[model samples]
Target: MGFPDDTPPGLAGVLATLRGDVEPSSLWATLVDLAIRGVASVHCCKGALLSGGKEYLLRWNESSSLAPWEQEAIALLEGKRKGTEREVSLLSLFQTLAFGSKGYRKALEGSLEGAGLWSRERESQRKRVLLISLLLLFLGLAAFVVGLIGADAWLGLPGARAAVAALLAGAGVGAMVLFLPYLLVGALSSSLTDQGYRRGLQWRAAAKALKEELKGEGFNVERWGGDRFPAYSIALNLTDAFQEAVKKGKITAAPPWFSTALADKAEVVQFGALIALMTASSTGSAAGVGGGGCSAAGGGSGGAG
Candidate 1:
């Protein structure tokens, strides 16, 4: 199924949050979603981050009415409680993201959940997975012990049964081994309601379709348009794939919401990497701290006040 018609502004961001990783990529994806909605334009500039390296910059459009998350992002980037801005560096932008990252996510989650589109409780999700894993481990261990002690054999079927008990033991051991990995992944995973899980499958299918298109001959950009699908890719966490796909084409059809100076796929990938790096420094020193929990995701000290 397609994303709903009453889609909120940060659709990608919301979907990304449903993913539960909370990495900078989620924030990056949201930025792209906002840009596609006319909230900002993104591009790479040489002096944007460090003096020598490249980084992303967002140019906000004052005319576009803002989403709450969008407003918070801009306010954090500009270092103001409230106001509007024309441009902001992504280094500072990401830092702003890191500051209230949890608050930001919770806000989005609450809104989405209230609307019946979400049902992931992070801590509970981990706990539920952990409990299932422990139960499986206990069962496996019990089975192993019973098999080793000849309990199954004791519950005797005579000679041929001994071999059968051995098979049961092997099955238990396999269950233990298989479930061990499942436990670990699940523990680290975000839980999804049955509805959320189904929705996620749809998102995954969409991403797979986009990837197939990227690999096909004479890749068509017009069929997908510029901003919308790319925004979905970012939201889908296919950033690297989409960026690599761009490198294959001389993408001149830059969306007006993105930086127009971008000449080819390399620049597109350039900005993509910078967005990919958003999660890297999110835990940096909170040096420029002010009251109101303002801090950087990685470096800059900017937050709500």
Candidate 2:
């Protein structure tokens, strides 16, 4: 409920993605948050989706443990309706999980709006941009046409036609400037409301704190809520923090929720590397699902893009 506590960072990634400034990695973050809440589990397994390397086993703690958008993501998983406990694979995630499920994005955005983080009338911005561009184009063309028809026909000056040509050219250039760039793209779209803007300033400071707390020197993983950090770190685009912590011996063991098949068990970094690999490899896929980029809210309070 507060900024960057332990719950997958409050869907911060979703906010920035909808703002169109970044892609999202909220799916992974959300899963980790769910796991923290004792709703899911993920561990390295022995098979691959298409390649011949390792994959992960994802288990649902309960049949109805997911959020509505989360539900939409794995809605069609092979065994969702079988029983209280269910299992799926990371390989299957490629086929499942729409990073940008419109429903999911909309729902979170709506919640943020309700919480006064941003505005909800975003569709209107797109419409307004398109309408204004079209209007400007029509007006410019109409003026150019009328001007040409009503102009003095070089009766006294041979240069009159040339002058008219220059006017038409100028009008064309003006129209193109107004209609060809960002206006036609995502014109008038705004992600921050006044309250959101105030909150944004706080989020920046929070992000800096994240770097220090998670990756800074001599940081103790156990004292830092290690279990939540590994996954949430990735969601927040601080995979380095997780990796660095492991490399420097700050993290020697993984939290219980993250495990491997080997009896001796993989090193923390190995498991982390696999997590990073799977997430990066699936970046393209997350974008297809509607995730904008690597981002997440703080442990609870703020967001990062």
Candidate 3:
């Protein structure tokens, strides 16, 4: 049957039929009837059989490396005793089953395993990047404070030594007030993202879980191995929606810290520069006032003497 790609092929088709807008569960009984009629493959102890009578031949044109159990099942199904009912275990079926060819199972497992390992490595790299960013932020604050205090002495502030201590103390408080929340947010978010990919799931399950965990809300479960697959290459991108939501919440809770720190430092520098300019202006004003007073006093003395 040439079922449209948009619709689910097997079990998926059953869902599509049931969800017609005009009818709720209208196809429910029909779906069940089809299932009972043996349109679906039934699991026997050793393998899945295309039920509904006579022995059907399944061609195995796959490469070598068929698991031992898979080879045995294929042989049993192909042998002269094919039609006879035989008991098979569920564990044996999956462990030994080949869907179409040996390559299908190998390809699927190989892709999933490779993507899983890559996700782990990607997370480790993100942690390293975030840690480095935070460390640099702290270092920048320290450098700014030191520069401010050092400038104070060169600018000839009263009790220059004391000013440096006061500036350092204030800068420490300011940096803490600005940075603590951002650091906490990044740490928490990174932790959550890291944990999300620690176990590999189909992209759809990961997306659904991520949405639920972060937003506590609705998200569609995607069908994996289809078009529009989530980027498994980057774990960070995989959970980006969740990460973005958390980041927004963090920013709302506390303004951007590193930027705040730099802003505060800029304000302090501006205030210092203003004060320096004012001091120079005031000295000139005092000299002018003193000179005028002295000239007036001398003129009066000369007239009196």
Best by TM-score: 2
Task: Name the runs in model 2 displaced over 4 angstroms.
Answer: 1-10, 15-23, 48-52, 63-85, 95-99, 126-173, 180-189, 212-226, 262-265, 285-305
The ten-residue window of minimal lDDT in model 1 covers: 296-305
Q: How accurate is candidate 2 locally (lDDT)?
A: 0.54
TM-score versus the correct structure, for each prediction: 0.58, 0.65, 0.21
Q: Lowest-lDDT window of 10 residues in candidate 2?
A: 296-305
| Model 2 TM-score, all chains together | 0.65
Record all residue pairs in model 1 with backbone atoms less than 3 Å apart, i.e. clashing: 95-296, 95-297, 98-297, 281-298, 282-297
User: Per-residue alpha-carbon lDDT of model 3 for 1-305, expressed as tens digits?
Assistant: 11123311121211222211111111111111222222211111111233211111112222254433233333533342223332222222222222222432233223333433223344455466568658756865785677566765546556666566566657666765676666665554321123223332233344455545445433322332121211110111232442343344421221111011123234323222222222222223211101011111111111111
In model 3, the runs with Cα more than 4 Å from the true position are: 1-113, 116-121, 133-158, 190-305
Model 2 Cα shift for residue 24 (angstroms): 3.9
- Of candidates 3 and 1, the better by TM-score: 1
Q: Candidate 1: deviation at residue 288, Å?
A: 22
Error of 3 at 203 (Å): 12
Order of candidate numbers by lDDT, starting with the best = 1, 2, 3
**Which of the two, 2 or 3, has more TM-score?**
2
Q: Spell out the clash pairs found in candidate 3.
A: 45-88, 45-89, 46-88
TM-score of 3: 0.21
Q: How many backbone clashes does candidate 3 have?
A: 3
lDDT of each: 0.54, 0.54, 0.30
